[model samples]
Target: MKKFNIFLMLIFIFTTVFTACEDKIIDTTEDKIQTSIKVTHINIPYVYNVTNESDITIEGKGFEQTDSITFIPRGGQGGGTIKLGIKTIEDEKVALENSPYFRDGEYEIRIQRGILDQLLGRTFVNRIFNASIPDREGMTVKGTVHSNGQGVANVIVSDGIEFAVTDQNGVYYLPSAKKHGFVFITVPANYEVSVINTIPQFFKRLAGLASATEIKDFELFPVNNENHVVAFMTDMHLANRNNDLTQFQSFIEDVKNVYEEYKGQNKKFYGITLGDQTWDQYWYSNNFKLENYVDQIKSLEFPIYNVIGNHDYNPYVSANDWLGAAEYRKVLGPTYYSINIGRVHYIILDNMQWLNDGGSQGVVGERNYRDFLDQEQLTWLAKDLSYITDKSTPIVIATHVPLFTNPDQNGNFNNAMENTSELLAAVSEFTNVKVATGHTHINYRNSPAGSNVYEQNIAAVSATWWWTGATSAANHISRDGSPGGYAIWEMTGRNQQWYYKSIGFDKDYQFRSYDLNNIHITSATYTPSATDEFKGKVAGYAGEFATANKNNQVLINVWGYQDNWKVTVKENGNTLPVTRVRKKDPLHIISYEMQRLNANAEPTSSFVTVNSAHLFLATASNATSTLEITVEDEFGNKYTETMVRPKAFTYSMR
Candidate 1:
């Protein structure tokens, strides 16, 4: 119904000549006779530098000396309408005394009712690209930020070391050394560049010498993404190993389904991965890397905005940490930049500082990296936010590393972000701020009391690096037992709600329950053929499930649990006692760890189950008593399970 209203509003929106009321911008049209005025085209220059350019001419026929025109911002963001005096008006063309662009976006031109009889308030404002930016002595790269054959002004272009803003003609020239081998744009609001195979071509790859001049223009498409949704895909370690390619196909299907679902609702759907799209260790050995990743993600429906994870760096570069991202910048674009989508502002960053000490060509490095926003990124973020006058606008920071530590059952965590305070201080002015990160591959949220920032450490698409489910166990799961999945963020205006979408499950599949009475994982039961050297590790991994527990305790794993979500359990229509407990999911332990041990292989430490706070323990009256469990997510989505007594715990249990 809401979507239908939007369509109706678009169909019947009234636009016309202005009214005499100076303070109020009229919305209704005038009922006067129309005039025949033809505008061949407006000749706003291809580029304009503010220092030397000021006047912009509008071409066409009908012109009046006292015509009033106003430039109104799209989305009602920036400010109100901007008005300038008309220098000369003629039937052929008119020149306006224009000033520097105070804002960056698409604006509408509204003329006084009488001046434009038939065509008054419905025309789009032509942007004037010109600033007084002087050219450096030696300019190596030049480019234009254009859309629909018109130059875009105030669009920032950078070559890693130096930054330049487009002139009145939408032209930018950087006196760059070409060290980064590419020039990328910040991607101004309301416009997007070309996307090839789901990749936004926001940056151009430099082909020649640093001193040679290069011309690269960025073309953007105008879109109304005010009502859109973003799917946050993180840590999909697709390295062509462990049947990850096959597993990724299933992920693609899930994304296609989501795209269709949102498309039906008239919402613009987009996908942004929060890094670790490929395993660097297997870049050479497996002959699979970011290029392979691009091919895999090509099947996705929306344009892919990427974040550089720690594992995405070159295992061969040892000189500088940022140098490791040379390939990433070449393939994906800027390591840090900002883009506006609708009312929300998004900032993509590369927080991982790669430090592969022993790295050399053909020899993989340690692949070690620290997690924190570098000083350069912090500085860029501040400048980006300064343009956003509305402090209440939603700001989403997408990076590879999370700002907070993994919390236990009670939500207590230790050893948080390395530079959380500094990063937070940069965004302290914003009222609505959210930080979305991957790396942990576990689902958790941290919102300190009295703090404005809400950090949600999302789950991974390749659950446990595509291990458990790839095997005969047939269960794709994360370290916290959250199903291998991505997050679906629904943003309409400033109101945003997100859900963790487990692959092959409905949106309501928010939690899983285990009949603890039947969950007894003995070494002889799960891994009877374990080698003598690794047989002792079974009990260490199984925890309480190593022994029998017939206390009628039912364990529930709400992997997507946020602090505000509710959990309730009842037996025979009567309420049962429920306690939130920090426990490793028994099912994951049996699926990943036991499977590895049975094969006489050491379990990867990172793939093992970790104690999470999303677990809930409920006590029933007897072994034969039935139980009803219902979990409610923060968004009020309810997931319930009615379990009969003596429910069996098996490898395939849901």
Candidate 2:
């Protein structure tokens, strides 16, 4: 009976063990549930100067093979596929369209599986995804003071609205503005704003547009009781042994001659070398000394105020061991300091990086041995300007760069100061203000035309276009290779005038002055071809519009890279009548009609629409005869081009 019981117990134990094992396996399989991964949105950070992708690690797990990944933008737009495995995790680039430039919102990434083919072992699944690519905003307004192109710590700065002193390296920060606005320094008494007159205008608006924004980069003209004729020049880029420097002496001679001529007639004159007065050849070498440069500048008879340029700072000369101010101090004075000439206040600014070309010029003054402006100077500027009781006293602001467009349309003037908008608001409260600057070789004059102030950009007195030869065939020379010029600004009682006169080494100096009273583009005319396929070239009277034949279309190429191409035929700003063409068709000999305002018949650029004219031309291979083209400018400048249609016979008709 016991043997029977034992057999029964063994059978029972075996059955229980088998049942328990089966239950455990079922529970483990149930715990492994499908996750159904879906990518909702991908956030890509904003990048301006940087070329690489800001945020690369894409979120959303459970990426299945053969799944379709579609990118859907927020606004009404088409979708695109996301090519995976093509780019490694390390190498990813955010395309321009997907960047903060145009699209700045969430995007849906839809993923679907089993749509094209059947899954091997898993069940069919569909997943929807979305991700946000936020728009990159502009940086806040910050100020960094620099001395000797190096930061001098603890400089105070006030934008008249917000005030902050720079830290150890002469850096300060304030809130940013919504749009591109003007700003000036409440400069301390001992220190001056880089450009005191017009002030540095910061442009935060129109970012990432088809064209880069145009902000004034230099200082404005001086406005005081003195009817002074100041000669302004900068970015000479003079090396100790270069031909451009040789030509610069000639410019000085010309200025001296002009001043002497005026002086002989009992006229008053003054001069200011904006910055970069001398190219420090000793930047990396100890062979040359600061006294060598100072001696050369002292050669000029008149008292020339020198604004500190980047080249003034020498790397070989240690800033900490040497004088507090760089070697330039002996010749140019304090880097962030200012000078008062008669009723006008002059502020010399340092805007280069604190470190060398290889390093980044930090917002704070201390990081780089390079470009910066400190707090002490900014404090002095505010205190000094505050003392001026007469708000009408015209302020003449000067700097290496204008607050707007520098040499090319790409440069900005308010680079060093963070509180540029606040400073501009302060200056805007004043009645009269003007900003003038150099560094850019090109000349730009802005008056109440587009904005609310007057600004002037002076041309370089040194090498123009880096003395790049006209063509590759021409060897690259220095000043002899390009045009070198200086400016003579006349500050009168009622209005201010700027004369950008190019004084070549030996050529006769000429003066070109502009005023708001007579700002217009005159006549713009083009000739058409006779053949069915318009085959001809069009010429114009002005420099802006030229003649060209493209795809049997006579195109009067209007609009320069800097400004639009518009023309008028008379002295008074008026447009002539124009003939209409096809609806929105590429223009062909078109016209823009304008009513005459005055009887002055003298031809000026304000009387006709140069852009309104257009002409069609035949294709190059389909031409049969000679096409004549003519264009005229308001200044009576005429250009002509002929397009010879291809003839069937090789020989001439004659």
Candidate 3:
């Protein structure tokens, strides 16, 4: 009887262990199935009524009860995740409604699930036509979105408050409300609106909408080729100065000359201006004068895309953030937009935010400037990028202010975008991306933390704010001593190459060099100072050294220097190591000092010098021999300049 009892106990223990192991295997398989959710189809209307909530249904596989739906509205309205009203988890179908606050515009929807933070699927929806009645008798506005003379369907067209999607024939219509001046379209992927006179022709004014009915049609061209070239020029800052307009004309001539060369190669060329098209913002009272600048830019025959700068804002406008760009929108259309060229996607964003402080101009006084991209713009960016099917496509982001830059000694970031991390995060999935900006009037390149993307800060065309010193050789010299220049980027397949072109210099003139002896300084002796007194002395010393002996170190500023570029100094068939140093340009210091000592200096010559990132230093032996400097830009273009070492001079200062 004892043996039989023990046998029963053993059987019970073995049965329990086997059951536990079987349960573990089943759970593991179930978890794998749960996470393998696949979205097959989503049933959503192309357009919705702004005032009415419509049911949205999504169909997929492996959706669980833990999954949630999120709707992101475009045009600056932030969206939130929605509570599932009716869900069939087993069928993988979920239904939700548009948020009550959703306006008449475009929106994005996403399916999210699990603690691992996964996005199951995403799509876009457009809320067409205004829900509210028009203040005045409504006029029917109709238009068709066409690409290459063929109607393109499902394009979103809007009049700020009301949006409509083009039908199968690419035709759309909306009842125009009172005070609606323009009817524009959210340009579709792979197609761009007609650009006329450097201004994007995406909208038609209401003046042509006489008698309650207007017919407007948009023409979009294809830029889907693999080889294309883009010309980036910024900070024209055109004003009523003595030579400002003439300088702009000369810059245009240079662009024409360059474009002609590219045209000969049969390369497609596109032009983009980063911002600060006018300096009239200096007098906030004369905000209307911006119209003059707009007209002048519109006179350019080529279609030069533009982004908004702080100087483009109307200081007197007292509206909210969305309406703050009213005047700019009236002239420049959308402040943010996107276009596609070949495998490259280009996005232009307006990073300037109005403070509503009624300040006279930008970059003056403490707390004068703030950089931010409104939540709406961020939402738009996400939605726009979603439509892109190619994950490996390269993207080019252009804005007026740099998205990333080094802060000042006080930990202040006056020149960089405050939300850089967020922007970088949004584009992190894109492997090949670059940002181009113009505002500092200095040329430099920087890559933000957490990403390998590079942001190139192109120098201004109106260098030193149109300030030309009487003794200076060039009318426009940036405060950092970089010649006023623009950048030309050539994209072939997945590869891109760029070079900075100085306004009056040859294409090969990528950098400038100086004799350290003439500047009377070595990297060891040169110290950066913030005090006004010391700065004044340094400026004077630089001016005096320009005419002194030239027998010491060689300093070179490669305007478009990047980490990949190779710079070296050779003397007597021996190569010397070059040290990268943060030093202000000696020529810029001399220009500033000359302006201070000689009151006859041009008004634009008063710019303060800032540290240059591209400056390289190397010492040479005191032998009077030819010092050869060689620079190879990232594109493999080699530039060489030879300077003769001068005899050492001994000067005794009393």
Best candidate, TM-score-wise? 1
Question: In candidate 1, what are the lDDT values of residues 443-523, reduced to their tens digit?
Answer: 888887788999888999998999988887899988898898999899989999998899988888888888888888877
* lDDT by residue (tens digit), candidate 2, 1-654: 999999999999999998998899888875453244433344432222221243223333344444544444432111233322212222222222222222211244444554332211211111101112122234344434544444445443433334455567555554434121222333332233331111221111112222222121111132333555667866666655434445556666777676676567543455676666655543334344444544445455444556666555654333341232345643343444444454565555655444533321221122234333344445645665665677777677776655554222222233323544444555665677776676655445444434445566665676332232222112222121113566676555434554544554221222111111112223322222222222211222222223232332222221111122122221122322322111111111121111111111222332222221122112222224344433343234343344344312111110
* Order of quality (lDDT): 1, 3, 2
| Displacement of the residue 649 alpha carbon in candidate 3, Å | 15
Residue 624 displacement (Å), model 2: 21
lDDT: the better of candidates 1 and 2: 1
TM-scores of all models? 0.77, 0.41, 0.67
Tell me the whole-model lDDT of each prediction, alpha carbons only: 0.79, 0.40, 0.66
As for TM-score, the candidate ahead, 2 or 3, is: 3
- Ranking of predictions according to TM-score: 1, 3, 2
Off by over 4 Å in 1: 1-142, 160-179, 206-215
Candidate 2 TM-score over all chains jointly: 0.41
Candidate 1 lDDT at 639 equals 87
Cα lDDT tens digits, model 3, 1-654, are: 999999999999999999999999999988887774456654554443332455556665555566776666432222344444444454656655545544333456556655444443333343332233233345477766777656789876766455677888787777766245667776555566556446667665443324565555666776544676788988877766636766667777888888888878877777888988866345343333456676666545456777888777665453344555666666666787776666788888878676755533352222134788777678768876776667778889999998766332222233367888788878888888899999888887776445658888898887777664223334467777777778999988778989998887778987777766655632123334233444444434454353445557777887788777899899998998898876777666544544443443232333676776778888888746678889998777899888676523211100
Backbone clashes, candidate 2: 118
**How displaced is residue 527 in candidate 2, in Å?**
34
Clashing pairs in 3: 76-376, 198-304, 467-604
lDDT, model 2: 0.40
| Best-matching candidate per lDDT | 1
- Cα RMSD to native, each candidate? 20.2, 25.1, 25.3
